[model samples]
Target: MNTNKELEYCNVAVWFDRSTLHAMMQALVEAGLNVAWKESQKQFRVTVYTQHGTSDLTLLRLNGAYKLDELDYCVRDMRLALVLYQFIEQAKGHAIVKMMNQDKIVVKNIRYGEAVRIVEIKGAEKKVIYEKACSVTMDQVIAALKRRDAEERIPVMRLELDYELATLYDAIQAKDTAQVKKSKDRLKQLRQEMLLLEA
Candidate 1:
């Protein structure tokens, strides 16, 4: 991995049932959606990668009524206001959710239920969810910042690198073997390369 580089997002895939996937895909196609990627399995369900922001994958679950355990995974973005609204309208029944991620977007429902046209994001909305649901990653944010900075960077990184190098030299003199081995060597080289890039 290039330590200096970053990425915006990964290939997010949406999963649901075969019938529901087919229906949504059909609706999207009719709505003039250009699907980026998709695959289906009757034994399991359907997974799709879309060109748009997020795809609806509501029908995949049969509620707690299914023979499976933790059926909430059937609904991907159950926390997303629009997705939740639509899913609730589609699923019709009060959807069961085992876990919801930080973004309130992707959810892990162990069960699924009936299908319809999702009504509102929160005929089933809740407050005080976990931070783990959806939060910006350090690397992703850093990558975005670096992308904006390009080769010539800002004063803060300069200060951080200077502080790191000083700390590295101090550890070397103090014979802090663990810090020397873990941080000093790689950090020194990387900082020097970055400094040269800056100059």
Candidate 2:
């Protein structure tokens, strides 16, 4: 897997069945996003293809994991979009549209108050992954659970929201729908935003 962001856009490279890859692909198609033409089926790519804030935000809600790198715009967004879509589906319970990238350490080379020191922003973007995956909370879990029959996979679908995912992973892992409302509420904002783009 590979990932990177440029000009409010992010790109990803993915392999088949390699964690959340499927979901990423579905999201792009479902969201009316496209795939890059340069890539072959063996190693595909996907990206956030719009400049609109809401569209971009919708694309950001992904639950995929394993970023190859932060993209440099040298590549096309279409391919990147397709690649990420695949990644989201494969990750399953481990998937989400956002994550708290705690490893960030940004420094300001300018003045103190005049220059805001950028730091501690969420890096593992679940929104992008989920959007790329084209998956809602319920569908993801259902698909992941269904995978168990194909092989020996576990029945779990981790959410792509911020706070709720932290709490929802266990619920999906346990196949418990008790907190389904909570997960929906946590993702309520993004859900509406994504739908608005489609409308």
Best by lDDT: 1
- lDDT string for model 1 (77-168, tens) is 22232343343335322343333333333332211132211211222565433232323356654555556453234334444555777877
Model 1 residue 146 lDDT score: 54
How many times do residue backbones clash in model 1? Answer: 27
Identify the leading candidate in terms of TM-score: 2
lDDT of 1: 0.38
Q: In model 1, which runs have C-alpha deviations exceeding 4 angstroms?
A: 1-21, 30-44, 51-87, 96-199
